[model samples]
Target: MNAAEVVKSLLVQRFGIPSAHLNAETPLRSLRLDSLALEELRVLLEEQLDIDLEEVSLTPRNTVGQLVAAVDGVAA
Candidate 1:
């Protein structure tokens, strides 16, 4: 899967969000993800995408596009 698909799948799996609402610009804060969930997402990304995000912190305000960008940036 592509980065966008990876991001969407992660959000859906981690937050139990339906695919219909998993837009590229959706704000993570709207889902009310707790700190633990965020950490879980970080681990998920590392394990699935092989991208280590532990050093680069992300926040709720970060959009799916931004997250994908960060991943692409790190991979590059």
Candidate 2:
């Protein structure tokens, strides 16, 4: 799966998020993921995607599409 698909899968499977609530434009905060959860997500993404997230500025204000793009950019 691509970064976006991995992200969406993680959100739904690990976080118990409904698939219906997820979309490219959805804000991170809308998923109710706390700071720790976000951190965990970062680690999970890094491990799963084999990409460094250190340079990526992820915030609650960032949309899912933005995060996916950041990961894809780094992976490429």
Candidate 3:
């Protein structure tokens, strides 16, 4: 799957978010993800995408598309 699809799947499968609420422009905080959950997501993304997100500057305000782009940026 592409980065966006991977992110969406993670949100649905790991965070119990409804697929209908997910979109590239959606802010991650809309899913009610706490800091711990966000950290877990970071780890999962790092593992799944083989990219280190420690320096990616991710935040609750970040959109799904931004997250995907960050992963894509590191992967590239």
Per-model RMSD to reference: 1.5, 0.9, 1.1
Off by over 4 Å in 1: none
lDDT of each: 0.78, 0.89, 0.87
Candidate 3 is scored at a TM of 0.90
Pairs clashing in candidate 1?
none
Predicted model with the maximum TM-score: 2
Q: Summing lDDT over every window of 10 consecutive residues in candidate 1, give the lowest-scoring window.
A: 28-37
TM-scores for all predictions: 0.83, 0.93, 0.90
Candidate 2 lDDT, tens digit per residue, 1-76? 9888999999999999999998989998999887788889999999998888988878888888888899899989
Regions more than 4 Å wrong, model 2: none
**Between candidates 2 and 3, which one is better according to lDDT?**
2
Model 2 clash tally, residue pairs: 0
Error of 1 at 13 (Å): 2.6
Best-to-worst TM-score order: 2, 3, 1
